[model samples]
Target: MKQTALKRWFNSGGPGVWLSAGAVSIAVIMTIGLLAVIAVRGLGHFWPSDVIAAQYDVPGQESHVLVGELVQSEQVPRARLKGAGLPVPDQGPEFMTRDLFKIGNRDISPGDFSWVIGEWLKDQRKPAQLMTLERREWGNFYGYLVNVKEDGNVIAQGEAAWPQLQARIERVQGISDQLDRLEKGEIGAINHGIERLRLRARKLELDGKLDAAAQADMASERAEFDARYKAVESQLAALHADFNRDSLTARDGNGKEIEIGIGKVVHAYQPNAMGTMTKLGFYFQKLWEFLSDDPREANTEGGIFPAIFGTVMMTLIMAVIVTPFGVLAAVYLREYARQGVMTRLIRIAVNNLAGVPAIVYGVFGLGFFVYVLGGSLDRLFFPEALPAPTFGTPGLLWASLTLALLAVPVVIVATEEGLARIPLTLREGSLALGATKAETLWKIVLPMASPAMMTGLILAVARAAGEVAPLMLVGVVKMAPSLPLDGNYPYLHLDQKIMHLGFHIYDVGFQSPNVEAARPLVYATALLLVLVIALLNLSAVTIRNRLRDKYKAFED
Candidate 1:
């Protein structure tokens, strides 16, 4: 091929040469331009210098300014803090618990403080009060550690906030209730087992000469039984102290009862995670954290961890489910089966399946897996668990299986091409050396085709991660309280509901009641997913290219 190509190159001074050269040059230029544009836009998300910080205040009155020091305080002036009698700070640092500031707490939502510093400077009103100083920062006013409460020299404090009298009262009641239950013999004491064991030991001691090992075993059992009984007793005491009666009852200031109705406290608040963040500064420090964090009723500790987990799990499961079946099928077709009418028909069918719309698979999965198969299992195995679900519920397993079916054709096609690419001489030589057909197929063919198989897997992952409609039919919940796997009894709970990044982006952008606020997150999530898929493809392509290079010398 090299000699022929060299000969042709020397002979060719015609339109074909010029056309190919022009095409290559054009492609190179276009690719460079595209990369430059994407780099400018995508990397721009991380540059910190261009942050447009703003805060909100009264329209007419001049807002207070912080000229030299940026004050960070939860306390607004008593006059400005109250809104319609509620203690809502108008423009100040939000009150946050230590836990709320972490990367994990999705329950916390970001608040709005939109007034401009320039407004505070021009306005005759007092400056933005300095509350808390992070450290002794003298350069740029990063944030403030101390608020206007200048009276106390010791500003930073984390003292014990003693429990109120009512809380103590509740703890006493909780303990009393347990004591009453014990008195009434509503629950048997764990020590009854110890008493029985002691009586048994006494009887056995009189009648038998036990061996040393037997005596040690008996002692060990006694120790274990005693430990368990003590553990239960300790748990009862701890629960009484930890959750007072008030802990059971939810309430807010003013003694207003707080009841999270069936849907009332469905946490889906995505504040800063949403909204158009034109302020480029917001992106550099907190942008990625905000997007990948677990969801909140509002986007306070914005981390899209759940969404990332869901997307990765679904795609991985889809790959696991699809790869073997598709690759095996291709292997059999290429290695074992001879050319026949059936083979041609199967090929056509596989192609047709590949061409089928993704939504149809979603519907099929919903009907067959969720409705028929799941419904049947629910009735048979989990009749007692009716109304609630077991395997009969639409969830993670079904979603992955559905996507696997959808991805099978891609894997099959890639594997088939790979199988075809292997030279027939390699197979014949192996067989001639007395290697069995199965051995040749497995040892010689599959390893050679691995790179191509990986390419198929990459494409499959990309498709599966972006899928929304099919997952919607199955177990993709908008807000899964727990992940697919957890510290629960059954760690890998396939039946559990899962949050997906693809569907999450859709829900935030389109389905959210607060679409205006949620739109920015949609872009951010979309961008992250794109980056992930591209990385996956890139890795696969690198492997495929290396494989191709290695195999090049072996070909005819």
Candidate 2:
């Protein structure tokens, strides 16, 4: 009876249903697990970790003090440690515990990180007075504060020095903000004006209209810009002098006293002295900085604001370009085109295009869009900027166009399916009620299909935002300190190169010089990228659902 019942269940497709459910459950579990791992590794980096000061007693090496946060711990085979020339005793356990410490002070130390065998670390402690200096250069400085100085004169020492140092840092920060505004705002505008004047002169020369009057006018503009720049430069000079006026002395783990300029120190904190609430506030502050600041230290540190901006801007531009084109193509194929052998072939071709490798699109975009179309546009319209290759270079516009082309197939297929789903009676009834074919499509058919168009866009955005390969060839750069969109004339600079989060991940994870420093950033950046794509898709999905609900009565 049991065998007969099992056979009956198999024939009823019960096994297949259970197997499918199990597969979906496993996939969901795996995705959640991966996200959890990325969150823990990436988000934990911002927390104010207590700094450990320890005595190192490695065999055959002189004993010294080590200071920094404990970065990671691992178990390694003793044989591997011995092969690496660490004096590991082979008579004990097969595996030995190893701890990696972030021993910052890269300018003075051999490296920023060190690995010490667990058994050899002595007198490990987190002292409340131990200080960690987040710097503008050389990674970080881990030590004890000695005194604060103004110019060459010592003003505060010992416990009093900490508050004095903090006050000076705040003052320097204000000055730094002012200097940044002057340089990037005032000076930058003047420099841009001068360049524009120069370009105008070149264009006149090319047009054979470079008379004495034009030259005089160009020169006058150039001189005006120079005068403004001079004024801004003077302000900048004074700010710089003030910025460099104060300094602080700190004693390192090796008892060497080093003086760091106030302008160069970004943050100074005693992690061991921080309360739970203080640490939480500090964590949020660091996280915000990471999201808002430009990258430093060869993309190993700082924020990824540019990457975030570029990714969103590019994806949005691609959507704007692709939606109408994709929808139009789908309309022609499904609504107007004669149902013949050619129609079926075109549909097949589009479906296959969706499966093409993204790198192929990148190559095509570089060759055709950047070199051919962009070069022609530059020559005809921007002859003054020849050889500099304005539009002919890899930039934001080309990247967006490339991604649009790559995503068009998905949109076309989705819209076609939506169009096909609408009952023929609707179109017939619209025509019977005195509506033309065009009117039927516009008033009766298109609105119902809007939901499907959005579904296609959601898919396209999800795919395009995470695409790194094609963008790398077309526009994405390792460093783009100057954003494509700025306060310059013709504000949205589509021809300017921009950073992208996808390429940032690739560069930081694979191309960074500091592997240990880049690892956590990679995870953090990956998580951010995921969140960005999710947000984009979520917006599209919301629109699609609303459209679907609005047109539901028609379908019902």
Candidate 3:
């Protein structure tokens, strides 16, 4: 009876159903686990970690004191350390534990990180007096505040120097912000205007239309821009002077004293002295900075706002370009054109295109879009910018177009499927109501297929957002001097190269010189990318659900 019941269950497909459910559940759990790991590793990086002052005693070497944040710990075989040419003491079984420390002060130390054996560390203490300096360059500095100086003279010493240094840093930061605004906003505008004038003069010269009046107008505009530039430059000079007026003297664990300009310091805080509330506030502040600020220090130490902006802009552009073409093609094939062997062959071709490697599309885009089409555009309309290659270069527009081409087949297939699923009676009924085929398709058929179109778009966006290989070939760069969209005329400059999160991850993970420092940033960027893709997909899914609900009666 038990064997008969088991056989019946198997024959009823219960076992298969259970296996499928199990597989799906495992996949969901793994995805959630992966995201959790990434979040923990990435988000934890922003929290201020206490610095440990400890003495290290290795065999056959003089004892020395070390100060820095303990980043990680691990256990490894003692033979591994010996193989790596490190003197491993005979203790702690065949494997020994080790701690990795981020001993900042890259300016003084030979390296930023150090790994010490567990048996070597002694007298470890979290000293509240130890200050951590987040610098604009050279990673970070961990030391003791000695004094504060202004204009080459000591203004405050000992504990009093801390508050004085904070005040001076605030003043310097204010000046720095002003300087940034002047440089990137007003000064940038003036410089752009001056370039436009120069280009206009060149265009006139090429056309043999440089009359005296035109020359006078051009000269006047140039002079006005030059005057504005000088004024901004003078203001910038004064700001720099004030910004550099203050400095700080600090001593490291090795008692090596160094003087750092206050302008170079981004923040100075004693983590060991910070209360839980203070640490929480600092954590959120750092997280915000990571999200909003431009990257600095070889793309390792700062935020990724530009990358995020570029990614969303490129994906939106791709969607705009792909939708119409894909929809029209699908409409003609499935609605208007008679189905036959030719139609089947075309569908086969499109399915095959979807399977084509993305990098192949990138190569084609470079050759066709940037070189052939963009070069022709430059020669015809922008002759003055020739040789400099405005559109005839890898940029945001080309990247968008490339990704659009890569995603079009998916959209076409989806729209066709949606169209095929709609009842023929609906179209006939609309036509029977004295409606033309065009009107019937637009009003009755396409509306029913809108949900599918959104589904296709969601898929396209998910694929495009994480694509790195193709973009690197077509448009992505290590660093973009300015964003593609800005306050300049033609506000969206599509011909500018852009940074992308995918490439940023690849660069930081594999290409960075300081791998340990860049590791957490890689996780952070990956997490952000996942979140962006989720948000984008959620938006499309919402629209799709609404459309499906509105048209559910027709499907039924």
Best prediction by lDDT? 2
Regarding lDDT, does 2 or 3 come out ahead?
2
State which candidate, 1 or 3, has the greater lDDT: 3
Residue 171 of model 1, lDDT score: 50
lDDT of each: 0.59, 0.94, 0.92
- lDDT string for model 2 (2-83, tens) is 9999999999999999999999999999999999999999999999899999998988889999899999999999999999
Off by over 4 Å in 1: 1-288, 298-301, 379-384, 542-553
Model 1, 264-330: lDDT tens digits are 1112111222334533544554556555445664422246787778777877788889999999999
> How far does residue 307 in candidate 2 sit from its true spot (Å)?
0.3
Q: Estimate each model's TM-score.
A: 0.57, 0.98, 0.98
Candidate 1 has a TM-score of 0.57
Tell me which residue pairs clash in candidate 2: none
Task: Provide the global lDDT of candidate 1 against the true structure.
Answer: 0.59
Runs in model 2 lying further than 4 Å from the true structure:
none
